[model samples]
Structures are given as structure tokens and as C-alpha cells.
Target chain A: MEAVLRCEGLVKRFDDRAAVDGVGFEIAAGETYGLLGPNGAGKTTTISMVCGLLKRDEGTVIVAGEPIDTSSVEERRAIGYVPQEIALYPDLTARENLRFFARLYGLSDRMDERVDEVLDVVGLTDRADDKAEEYSGGMQRRLNIGIGMLHEPDLLILDEPTVGVDPQSRNAILDSVAALGSLGMAVLYTTHYMEEAERLCDRIGIIDEGRIVAEGDRRELIGLIGEADTVTLQITGADGCAERVAAIEGVESAQLEGEELIIIAHNAGSLLSEILVVVRDAGATVKGVNVDEPDLEAVFLHLTGKALRD
Target chain B: MTTALLLARKDLVQRLRDRSFLILGIIAPFFVAYILSLVAGPVYDYGFSADYAISDETGSVGEGLAEGLVDSGFGAEVVGSEDAARALVDDGEASAAILIPAPSPVGDPPPIVVYGDLDDGTAVVVAESIAESIANQSDAVRVLITETGNPASVGAYLGQEPPVGWVQGDAGDKVLDGITYLSVGMAIFFLYFTVQASIINIVEERMNGTLQRLLMAPVGRGSILFGKTLSSSLTGLLSMVVLVVATTLVLGAAWGPVWGVALLSLAAVVNAMGLGALIGTYARNAEQASQFAGIVATVLAFIGGVFVPISTEPGLFDTLTRISPHRWLLDGFGANSGTGTVVDVLIPTLVVAGIGVLLGLLAFGRRSKLTGVV
Candidate 1:
């Protein structure tokens, strides 16, 4: 019943900039915990600490209920790492690379079988014999994940595993990750892409500025900014149409996307009247209107003014 | 497969894949071996062409010896007078002026007075040789004096015969035996170089991130390093065996018992590998490692008799070479010849093994630093 992977007060600083600061989170066995954040938001650094590739400045990492030590060759064995960068030897064929890693993990006898299994899972069975460098971006990413599965570890820690991958390859990777969860492997998936986090993770932890600002079920996180709603209007109004809407009560922020004046508000029912009054005073006509529910993207934008891509 | 062998095999394959390593490892040894044969023996001869104004003071015999030298072997000049001889030697027109004194019989037929600055080894050998030939002639005159059973007319000019009790342990074989040490020493020295090159590959792997991939694979860094050392040492030992056996069996040259010589060479390879790893670890990158390795290996090779014969090295310098792995390997190699034992072979082998492992451990510190050198 213990969390498959746990971090308490983990903080890693490089050059006086906190890459991971006092970050604490836990992912249960058979669950995919996504670390969602923008670039340089400490996701990779946090995962690096978890993988034992980098030491934390201050924190305690418990992998499968055992204390983590940088020197614990045993502790390292329990965690499977797919680094942000492709860490496999480019010169080695996928099968050969898998076998090499398998032997390193001390599983020499049945490596052929395991390599075949992972290659099939990653949809790379046909291309497993090709050198890794010759692989397309998506194939490389798939093979990168296949490397992690070679040992069939209990806890799989993938850091930005799908970055730079084509949509098809990325979708295939997400399916493989979901399959790992079904097999009871704990998954700590880190990515800045919101859709991937929303699709793959059971619980999402929103990390920004080296700290986990909020982490919970997707519905629960969206609930954090429940009052945030996007109201779009087809307004053929005067020059001050946006200004009038901006002054309306319950409207938190407003912006125009081409023909639509998208106003984010706390109350959709009352804000429509206030918006209509402002448009009439400006001698404008309000046409089609739409109100949308809040999403993870809305929640993130409210928490930090910067967009996810920023 | 055993863990170490599996790791070692993979390591060797990776190294072979590296184009630079493949070229250097396969080609460099043969290239060096070919060069050594060409440049091995004496390179320069100190013979002079001088104007001859011979007076032939000692009559036909002096003239006969001089003519015999010019015609058959030693390149010499027959000068007419002492002044001409002095001028020829002084004006840089000649390396020496052989001034044969009229035979002063009683002591040692007037010692051949061949004169020049004496620091040069080749010059010393040539001068001493000329003196010995002249004295041999004088001693013949002494023997004739005894045979005739008379107080000879030139008693004072007669030379004494060489002593009858000349001792021998190894002095008799010095000239001919140098070739033996040259072959053994060169083989030992090349193994040392190859070991350094092996370590450079390891350093290259580490710097290029290949080592990180290799290490992250369930294999420990220790296993990777151990594999490297084993393969590199094997490479060195194999080259020695090939060189030794090729020269001995195919070329009809002898290097001693195949087993003993092979064992000695093998031990030397391990020692070289350890030294190489230590140096490889010392540098942060392959280029730096190769540079440091090359310089250190060169000094060791030069000291170990890859170039100049060790016998000619200054006593202190020769003794200093004992600390080098090259020196120990050569010692073990030399011991393999001339009434060697299992203990003799074991001592050097043990030294190489012990020191190799020790240096390997010291080099392990570099690996420790690299875990987070970034």
C-alpha cells in the first residue's frame, strides 16, 4: 500500500538557481503521476534526482519504501530512467542496445525474449535491428522508452519521454505507458505538454518555478480555479467594445482572438447583462455568444500569467 | 557469459567500432616495428679523409697495418708528417690522427697514440680497437724474441703478451648479446604504448557519453572499467606474443622458451594497462589523455630501452628505470633467459599485477569525480 515512489522536501540547486525546490509528491503503484510544467520548470531536475543521476541539495527520496542513496546500486536498480535527452548509444542497434542494457542489469539469459517483448510493445520490432541514429524522431523516442522496459522495473521514471516525437509516435508511447500501469508498474511521467499529462496521468502535479504549486486528480485541479470561465462573444460593436466588457462585474480578464472578444469571468449568468449594457452604450451589436468550462490550461494560466509554452 | 567477459567483449567491440582506435590499434604496432628494424643499429660512422705524407718510421709492419686498415675495413688517412697529421686532425679535416710511435719493445710496443676528444662512445671503441691491434703486433715481436733464444737487438721496443688468465662470466658475450635485450626491450616498450592507447579509448568513451550509457545499463562502472583493463591488457599481451613468436619461429630468431616469454610479456601488458588507465583517468578528455599518455609513455619507453640500449644509459638513469613498468617487464623478460625459474617469472608478474591493480584503483578516483564533473 506504500507509494511506489515518494519524494519529501526535495530541493536541487545549480548555480544558485533552484531547479527543484522543496518539491514533495508521491505516486502509488499502478498509477501514472504526470509532472506538468513549462520548460525549465524543474521537472527534469526533479526526475534526475529521482533516477539517482543527480544528487539533491536537500531532500529524502524513498523508492519503493527504501531510502535513496546515490551510491545505492540496489536503489538505482528499482528505478528505470529515460533521460530528457536520448541516452542510448546511437551506434548500437535497438536490439543490441536493449541486450547490452539487459546484461548490465544482470539479466543475460532471457534478454533475447525481453528485447522482443519490449520491441513489440514500443512498435519497433521491425526496426529493432537498425542503429539508433538511423531512427526517425518518433522511432528514437519509442526505442528510448523500450530501453526503460528492458529491465521491466517496478517503477518507471520517464523524463519528457515524448518530447520532439511525432504525434503518432507520441500516441503510441502514451499507450505503452498506460499498458505499464495496467501491469502494476508505477509511472512518474514528466512533460510540459498539458494534453499528454491530462491523457496519461491519474493524478497531475503542476510544477512551476521549481515547486509543485498544485497536484491532484485532473478534475480536482481544474476545480482550484472553478470560477474561471471563458465567455466568447460575436460583437460587431464600437471601438471601445473590449473596454466596456472589461469593466463588467465578474470578468477577471478579457482579450480578443480575431472576431471574438473572449472574456474570462467568475459568473457567466450575471456577466452577460453587464457585457450587453457596455456594448449598447458603445453603439455595438452583440451576436453569437458562447460560455466554456474551465480546463487545466485555464487553471495554469490563472496560477501563472505565462502560457504553458512560455 | 561471465559478467566480466561479457563486459570485456562488449567493450572491445565498441573500441573496434571507433575508427580512430581501429586504425591506431591495428596499424601503429606494425608501423613502429618496421621502423625499429630500420633505425636499430649504428646510424653514423666517424671516418675521415685526410692527406697522407707517410714516413713509415716503424718500416713495413706499420705501413702494412695502415694499408690493411684502409684497404679492408677502417676508413683511415695516411698522413706524411707529424705536422700534417696534427694539422689534419686540428683543421677538422679528420676525426683523428693515428700517430704510431716507433716500437718501444720492453713495455708495451709503443702504445698506439690515436688522439681525439674522447666523450663519444663510437670514437672510444674505434680508438681502443686501434691500440689493441698495434699491441697485438708488438706482442708477436715479443714472442719471436723468446723463440730466437737471444738478447734481441731492440729489447726496449718489444711489447708484452696479453695475460693468460682472462676471466669469463658474461664479459665474452657483451657485444653479441645486446641484440637479445633490444628485441625483448622493444617488445616490452610497445606493450606499454598500447596499454596507454587502450586507456585513452576508455577516457574517450567516458567523455563522449558512451560510458554513461554503458554505466546506466544495469552494469556497474567497475564492471565497465574492469572490462576495459582486461581487453587492453589482452591486446598488449597478444601483440607481444605475436611479435616474439613471429620473430622467433618465422624469422628464425630465438627469444627463449615460448611459455616463459609469453608469461613475462603477459605480465608486462597488465602493468602497462594499469599505468595507462591511471593516465587516462588523469585527463578530462581523450585528447588530453592521449597527450599526457604519449609524453609519459615516451619517457618510460626511452628509459626502458625502446630507443637507446640500456647498457649505454648512465648508471643512475639505468637504475631509475627500475621504477617504470617497462623496466620490470624487461627485467622479467631478461630473467626468462639465462637460467630463469618459476619464481623469477612470478616475481615480475606479481609486481606487474600488484602495481597494475593499485594504479587501477587510483584511476578509479577519476571515475568517482566524473559522476558529477558537469
Candidate 2:
């Protein structure tokens, strides 16, 4: 896959403080690459450098394979940035705000049409006539996102998009981000929420203390935790299903907790079907099933020997 | 969607929507005008002081002298004795005192003793005018020996001619023949000040997080800077328009031809706001920008002679005035009313614009560094 955004050896320092110290990453086309880190972990600083808002002290940020030089206007033109803060003018109505932004980008035709489409995507069509200041917190957040995508640039960078939003709005935003990924738009999504990263990102880079400590597919990161896989089954008709599950291929342990059976396996996927047969022979209804991998949180803790929040 | 037009539109709408803008744009200028009306016109207080006392015992001459001094606005009142008048002079209240000899002759010089005060500058003039008047009266009484001489025949001997010197609109001292340029220059001064404040929006926007939002738009810092400057220019121009009208009609000042002066005012507005943009970018907040603006505006006004003519030498102020936009505007006003030259007006216009462009570049260039708090 062609990498839409490529940053190498990016180092941004403020006086004596290294806000983003020697960081590097890339977001491929049609991928949601999350920059997962705690607060003050240089997530915002790194993103700012990539968006060309802050001149990096030392680095190379290439968007769509073209180098991003501050002297080059076209380089800036190809990038879209949704800041961590709400970026729209509150007093301006959504349509007016959109029109103003479109003009700023030097767009000529279809200004209204582009605004309508973004408003529709964020489900803010009904409230588009109102001033942005009058919108709910969630709606304002959505409008912030709307501004980011207005120009349809190759790389869309969102820095903590759902910071104070409600669950429904968060879900809507995450879903929109997923849709963007599917539409072949490269997205650089930064957040502290691990679940959001796990759910939406095709690849995840976990940053801490101004550095990307680890990055990979979900399982590859999970395997970095070195924890046993958890295989769970909701057996309906068997009395000794947990005992039978312990005897299946690759199963190392078993336990019965209430109506559920949990089998710990060294390699859980290899024995999952065999355990299902044993439960069926015992006449247990497999009403529900769950297979839990070692999550990114565990991987984070294993790599850093500390909780993600700490 | 041309960059300049787009920025101008955004700036226009934003400033129009601001309450502070409305106050500075409309209320503040008129308030200043109202205040100006209160203190406007020539400033003068005619005054006179006396150092003499005719004896109240005789009362008539004393009363006449007192009346003459009071009418000239030099506080004059009769004292009880010569000693009292002398005391008044010593105490600094009276600049001089005249002593009346007993049995004064009816048509003589009166042998009046004149005492003087050391510190008062006006005392000499008062004493001189009083002494001259007394001498003239004595001379007149002698001339009118009886009903022998007719007053018209005596008037021929006591003749006077009008003093000759330069006056503002007279044939000799008539450097400026009208109030047109002065009025236009005042209008430009205020219009420029208000418009300069309009560019304080950049600092306001940053403090309020509006700049952060603007940056997030695909708009970038350069565009935001341009937008703010455009708005400032428009408001400054609008203010000039209102000022020209207010000064011309309300204050009874003229600004020569309409079209040329209007264009001059418009260009001046752009230059003033361009400087305002530079100030706004460097200043941390609105208040700081305002403080800097005050000093800067005063300097610009001084250079331009908004308050007073910068120089008194012939062709000196007229030459140096080229450094200020106010001078350009004033010159344009003169040109239209057939008082000044295109060279005089146009040179200042270009100079003001050159300074404005330099300051504008400094402000906009600093903004790209992005140290503004989010």
C-alpha cells in the first residue's frame, strides 16, 4: 500500500523541552493509524509538526510521497488538519463558516454543495442553519471534524477528535473515521482511548514519552504481552463442560464461573472447534461465545511495565 | 474566492458583528466629535489689570478709571486709600498703583506716581496702556480749551492708522485660504485610529481560541493574517467616509472635491490598518495592542500634523508632511480645493503605503511561527 503520510526523524523541541523527540511514523492509504498515548505524551506536538502548523526543529514529513517543506504552498495544500481544540468560528452559521473556509482554500465552485455533504455526513443537516456557538458540544465536535474533511485532502489528521463528546457522538465519530478509512482516505487518528484505537485502527502505534515504543496489527501487539489466550463459552446444557473443555486440543486449563465455561489455551484458535464438539456431545447449548486475545492494554503494560494511564 | 477578496469579506463580516467594533466605529468617533464641539473654535480670554486708585473722595475719576479697567477684563476696583492701593500692589494682586496728588489740576498730567510689580509679565503692558490713556486724555482736555475748537477739527490733530501684520485668511498671511485641508486631515486621523484597533482582532482571536479554529480549517496562519488586515482596511475606510461627512457638514469644514479626496481617504485607511495589523500580531492582547497603538498613533499624528502643523518654516512642514498618510490626505484636500499639488499629495500617499506594507509583512510573517496559545 502507498503511504499517504510519511514522517522520518521528526524532532520538535521548545527551548529545553523536547515536545516530540525523534519520532517517526506513516499512515498508508485506506488505513486508520492511531497515535495512542497518554496526555502530554507528545501526541499533539507530533501531529502539529505533521500538519505544518509548527515548524519541526528537525524532521522530514512527506504527504502523498511529496516532501512537506514550509516554503512550499502546494505541500500545505495537500494536508487537512482537525486541531485538538474546536476550530470553527462559533458566531458564524455552519453554511457561512463552510463558505468562508472554502474560499480560504481558494475553492471556486460547489462551495454550498461541499458544505451540505459534510453536514449530512456528521448528521448535522437539520441544525446547519444555526450559528456554531449554539450547537451542542457533540455537534460542535462534529463540525470541527467537518471542517477537516471539507477540502478532501489526501491526509486527514485528527488530534483527539472525541475528547469531551458523549458516547453516541463518539460512536458516530469513530464510525465516520472507519468510513473514511474504507473510502481510501489515509487517516492519522490520535487518542488516549485504547478501545477506540483497537476498534477503528487498521494499524496502531503506541507512543509514550515522545517516542513510538511499539506498533503493529492488534494481535501482533497483543502477542507482545506474552499472556495466555482466553477461550470462553456459554454452555447451556452441560454440567461438566468446563472439565471437558480442559481436555481439548491445546487447552492448558479450565474453569467454571456461573453459567459460563472458560478455557485457557497456549494457542486458543487451534482447539476452539474441538472444544465446541465436546460441549455438543455433552448436550450443552452454545448460546453465546467469546474468545479474548491479549489486548493492546496488556501489551502496553508488558512493554512499559506500567499502566497506560500512568 | 480570490485570496484577497476572500480575506476582505471575512474581515468585514467579523468586525461588523463585533460590539467593540460598533462602539469604536460609531459611538466613539461621535463622542469625540461631541467633545470637540464643546472645545472647538478659537481660544481667548481678554484680560486687564490696574495699578492705580483715584481717591473715592473725588469718586468721579476713580470710578471712570475703575470702569475702564474692568471693561477690559483686568480686574479693577476702587481701594479706600492710596496706602491700600500701594498695599494691593505689594501683595501681588495689583500689578501697579497710581497715587493721586492732592488738589489735582483739572487739565494736567496728574503727576500720578506709578508703582510696578516685579513678577507679573502683564503688569508692564497694563501700566503702559493705562499711562497712555491718561496722557491721551490729558492731551485731549488741553486741546479742547473751550467750546472754541470743534470735535471734528480736533480729530484731525489726533490721527491713527490700523496696525499692519499677517492674519490667517488675509491677502498677506494667507498660506491656507480655507479650512478644507485641516478638516479632512482631522477626519483621517480618527478614522485611522478606529480602523487600527480593528486589527486587534488577531490578538483577541488567539486569546479566545478563534485562531486555533482558523488554523484547523485548511486555512493556515497566512490566510488568517490576511483576513484580519482586510477587515481592518475596510473599517478604517468606512470610518474615513463617516468622518469626512461629519467634519464637512457638522463642523462646517470643507474637503475640496469629493472623488479625489474620497480616494485619498481610502488609500490612507489601508495604510493605517496595515500598520494596525503589525501591531496586532506582536501584541499579546487587545489592551497591549491599544497601548502600543496609542504611542504609535500619537507619533504618526505628530509627524502628520493632525494636532498641529509639524513645522513653522516656509516649505519645511509642507516638505516633511510627505512622511505621513495624514499629510497625503490633507494635501489631497488642498489639491481638490485648488490649494495643493498632486506631487505633494501623491508622494505622501506612496510613503505611507510603503511603511504600511513593511509593517504588515513583519506582522504576518511572525504569525507563521505559531507560538500563539491554543
Q: What is the interface RMSD of each candidate, in Å?
A: 3.0, 3.6
Displacement of the residue B18 alpha carbon in candidate 1, Å: 3.7
Give lDDT tens digits, candidate 1, residues B274-323. 67777776677788878887788778877765565444333576567766
TM-score of each: 0.65, 0.68
Find the candidate with the highest DockQ and give its number. Answer: 2
Model 2, A212-254: lDDT tens digits are 8998877678767667888888777678777887877678888
Model 1 chain B worst lDDT window (10 residues): B166-175
lDDT, candidate 2, equals 0.66
Candidate 1 residues A1-310, lDDT tens each?
7798889999988888888889999888899999999998999888767776677789988988777755556667777877666766676788988888887787778888988999998899888889888998888877878888778787898888887788887888788888989988899999888888888999999999999999998777887876566788887745767876787767887776676788888756567777877777888777888988666777789788778889
The pairs that clash in candidate 2 are A87-B213, B48-B73, B48-B74, B51-B96, B51-B97, B52-B98
